[model samples]
Target: MSLPRIAIDAMGGDEGVRVMVEGAALARRRHDQFQFLLVGDETQIKSALESHPNMRGASEILHCEDVVGGDEQPSKALRRAKTTSMGLAVNAVKQGKAGAAVSAGNTGALMAMSKIALRTMPGIDRPALAAVMPTLEDEDVIMLDLGANTEADARNLVQFAIMGAAYSRILLGRKPRVRLLNIGTEENKGFDRLRDAAADLQAAKGLDMQFDGYVESDKINRGEVDVVVTDGFSGNIALKAIEGTARFVTDLLRSAFTSSLRSKIGFLVSRPATELLKHHLDPNNHNGAVFLGLNGVVVKSHGSANAAGVANAVEVAARLLEDDITNRIAKDLAELGEARLRETNGGAASEGTGK
Candidate 1:
């Protein structure tokens, strides 16, 4: 079979075309079967490709003179969709010219363009931004609604759970342990939407998931659950808080290690262990944030990410395409529909009997 070509917004990231092109080259080395559609300025992209001989052979440049600004509003960005590098890359996926699109540009703009161009999949009212984060255990945890939508209702929350589980299956290769993020673990702790969504998930019969009820924010990184579902507003705040805390701890450790000569000596002795911890906590290692529930795959790479980060994001897009994630989501939705139908029928029968 032919390898799926990934559309890259070469002009997107803060590091400019050079970093994006280099990252694509690195990803090509990791995934030999992948091809690239490099969308950006022809002269700049060609010049950047000169530094990456291998990428030249695997990629074709699509000239796009315009770019979406980092601070541009989604509404204004939408108006420039035809000429912007990010827009063109996403359009390639919608046009079937590429299997997936990856951008390290404005998050809001990318989300807006992707939704407008590709639309959401059947049974998905809104697409959620899902990303994997390091945990205390050896594996990573998947969390969703990371600022895709500010608020979500019961149905939206339930859909996020299903979508998150499907992504977990692809990444973990099995049914994932899913949970709703809430203030408390008790059944009646959260608001009406949380309780309603929990009930729906509990009653869902055909979903390939293990719903583990509510999971408090404090336990998110404990590796207790494989997937955590929540509203975008909450999820975004939690994600940022986790990031900030990681930075704080690392900074404090650095300060402690260099406080005195004795501490410096100790740091040298523990350098290897510290290096491993640094690698584990590096944002570059977890650079991909996917917009799930879209008709086609779209990965949002961090705007300030380096080459390694961009490569990781590209790899994520390729994996989703290879795993046929969209189809898996559709199947899960079909199962949910069947379950709902059965429940309705059962309720009607009980009503008719009037016991």
Candidate 2:
């Protein structure tokens, strides 16, 4: 068996090189089948590796000098941040030096660089970022186009569903139930584009998966869908809403507990349950996001990710590479032919021609 190669952007996250290097070491310890290529400034990476010398020879460093800030325009950085760590890590995957790429850099910059370097699969219109989130049902739900295609058309939405479904199958080991995000479950509740995509998804062929129609935002945590698809603009908004709500509720609970002696006693009694909730909702536990529909496996981690979170993200990338996810996605997209059919049928037909 060939050992998996994962390229890590060593200087991308807020925690800096030490945490990223330690994360790679942690992942290597767990999965001995992977050899990581740590990309960053050579001097810093070497210094950090010396402090934590466990993965001593299992990892290697690829040096690059510049760094792109989160606020930099993605397109501009892709063209300009040529020697940056993010570009170097992604370039490794493009150059075949690595089986997959993992990064904790600026989300937009990472997406832009991956798209530019790896491009999209033959039948894919746009690449979507698919992230798994913990649900109230003790299982994770896959959410896609999380700021990838901000203004996607109906056809793009359908493509996101297909890509997300394939990912869910490979990673989650099941045929995911597909759902479209809408204002209501009613067939005519959303905008024209969403309604059209919902219909197209219903008529999609060659996928041995389940389509569960429209899912309202309220249904996200209720286990209503295994895979929820939407354009990046709406998906990003929904993601932020969930994050903010989780933090707000946690803070509210803490304030309530400290309000009075009686509440403090009650909180002490329920400390275990509160801790469980915190553990379950922490974004670090679900740190990886796959850039679906790309030619190569690219997993993006949160900017604020810690060492443990980076380790988990690396595991996700390694698993995707091992499962031959890129090949599977190519086969699925080629077999479906929906995207091509839409283009053939006058480019804007009311009904999808899954020809």
Candidate 3:
């Protein structure tokens, strides 16, 4: 069966049209059923399409010349929503011209445009930025509120957990183990919002995943937890710290290997292991970050992503569309949302949890 047509902001990435078109073509190669609405400069898109005949037959160009700058603020970018490539791609999703939108642009601008154009889904206070991060185990972890909102109440955190768990169900193909990110695993640790969110999740009946309490940042990539929920401020800081650490380790290894003749010989002996590590650590393998809880699907690709990374982002959008993720989240909300959690008292729910 054919997948939903994805709208791509072809001029949004660092390399602009060439890399975006190539990536879409690469994605179409992987899944021939995939089709696209390429939104960007008409001439540039057409020129890029010439090398990818496969894309020519499967894709259509929307011809948007205006592009959102990487440094532009969300408020400023909001004004160009009708004309900018990123805005137009998101608009295509809102207008039902495409099933999902993919962009490797200014994240704040993309988030702003998406929130305004698609709005939040019913029962969602705000949509969080969720992404797949590699873990020690084969199954990657799903983390959210990466930078969408700086603060979240207990209600929003509960909603984020629900959304993250639903996303995990899709990615993991089973009930996932969810956890709140906190300084400690103890019940009284962190603030009331953390404890309150945990309480609500524990009380909620028939949730698809297991919510066993909080997790520390050190355990995030350990593969023990499936979802890590936190406010944007904390989540974003954790994300950057993790990224910086990875870069630090890799650079350290490079410097070590080239330090002397004995080290270079050792590197040759360990080349196979290092190559495996390189592949595992490559961000291209996990390039798509989703705007969960939006009325329509929108994916954010890394601005510096190459064609392979862009292809992964496109494929991520495809998979979400195929599964009808938004409606599934809506269904989950309808069955057990704020009403169920808010109405149930803390004492009774705590007794039920036996904690």
The candidate that achieves the highest lDDT relative to the unseen native structure: 1
**Lowest lDDT 10-residue stretch of candidate 2:** 346-355
Please name the candidate that would achieve the greatest TM-score relative to the true structure. Answer: 1
Two-way TM-score contest, 2 vs 3, winner: 3
Ranking by TM-score: 1, 3, 2
> What is the per-residue lDDT of model 1 for residues 42-145, given as tens digits with 9 covering 90 to 100?
99999998888888778888999999999999999999999999999999999999999999999999999999999999899999999999999988999999
Residue 37 lDDT in model 1? 98
Each model's TM-score, in the order given? 0.98, 0.92, 0.96
Question: Candidate 2's C-alpha lDDT?
Answer: 0.85
The sequence of per-residue lDDT tens digits that candidate 2 reaches over residues 60-86 is 888887888778889888886568988
Candidate 1 has an lDDT of 0.95
Give Cα-based local distance difference scores for all models: 0.95, 0.85, 0.93
Badly placed stretches (over 4 Å) of model 1 are 353-355
Q: What would the per-residue lDDT of candidate 3 be over residues 200-296, giving only the tens digit for each residue?
A: 8888767787997999999999999999999999999999998888888889999999999999999999999998888888888999999999999
Model 3 clash pairs are none
